[model samples]
Target: MTKTIRTNPLFELYIENNILVINNGEDLKNNGHIKTADIESIEFIRELNFWNKILEVTFGLIVSVKSEYVRIRFKDGFKDLLVTNCDRKKVEYLVYDVNLLILKTQNHHY
Candidate 1:
């Protein structure tokens, strides 16, 4: 399955055939593919500041576009975002599925 992670104007990230596909949003420099074999791990983040976190817990709500992010970290210590400005809960599952693909790919499971 091909899952689109994010499609912001700066960059886009997706998973296709178990590979991380970087479709540079509207630009042309960042398009590329990352195999599971090349990465150390993937990380999902709720990029909220102190006030945002407080607001979320206090109000039982979150700002989707401001709080969601996914980070793809390579073995080389460089990190790339799977794009930003994401929706809450939705992007969480996408990140989870991407990690599953990473596991399968790294394990040579097809």
Candidate 2:
């Protein structure tokens, strides 16, 4: 049986073992689950301010950020690719996480 779980702005969707986990709370615990097929689509989080810098350094190229199945384009040419399935707050957290990732990568390189 398939059911659609109520999604929230702060939560993220993850699959473990054979069950889908909805992570919203601070503990990173699975609050709920639903069939994978029940998900209509995924909207990725975006870091616009970060991309602005990336754009200036890498001019003439399109930059995108991917989270789960969602892809966010920082350029006008890719705006049409934004996904509507994700809630804004949840996407915001995901974007913040991405920023942290970039920082970690930079630190490691240095």
Candidate 3:
């Protein structure tokens, strides 16, 4: 088992044997064996909210676009595995360590 990349009360994200595992609490919600060839694209988003001329909140999202599902990771502290349609073009606003996701998915190709 690979070291967990992120963990929260609702879900844990990790890469095991080149498979992306999203463990929902004690149950196995979904897992994906990632191949770089299977990834259509990866997108990163950073969100900022302003209040009183100061940035109040920040969040990050990493979206992995595959043919079957769009994997999304929010900032490491949240406990939600957001699942939606596989339309990669429609996802918006979430956060995570983008470089980590890219590295895992890309390096697994070999």
Best candidate, lDDT: 1
Tens digit of per-residue lDDT, candidate 2, span 5-103: 224444454444434455544334434654433332234544445766588468955444443234423323221123234555554455454444444
Model 3 root-mean-square deviation = 11.6
Clashes of 2: 1
lDDT of each: 0.64, 0.42, 0.38
Against the true structure, what is each candidate's TM-score? 0.66, 0.30, 0.32
List where candidate 1 sits over 4 angstroms from the true fold: 5-12, 64-68, 87-90, 106-110
Residue-wise C-alpha lDDT for candidate 1, range 8-98, written one tens digit per residue: 5544466766577776665466678877667767777766778878888899885554544467777668554544554445556766777
lDDT for 95 in candidate 3 is 20
Residue-by-residue lDDT tens digits, candidate 3, 4-106: 3234434444445534555544346454344333433444332223341243223333433222223443333223334332222322221233335566666
Please give the TM-score that candidate 2 achieves against the real structure: 0.30
Off by over 4 Å in 3: 1-10, 26-36, 50-110
Alpha-carbon shift of residue 28 in model 2 (angstroms): 28
For each candidate in turn, give its C-alpha RMSD to the true structure in angstroms.
3.6, 13.4, 11.6
- Global CA lDDT of candidate 3, please? 0.38
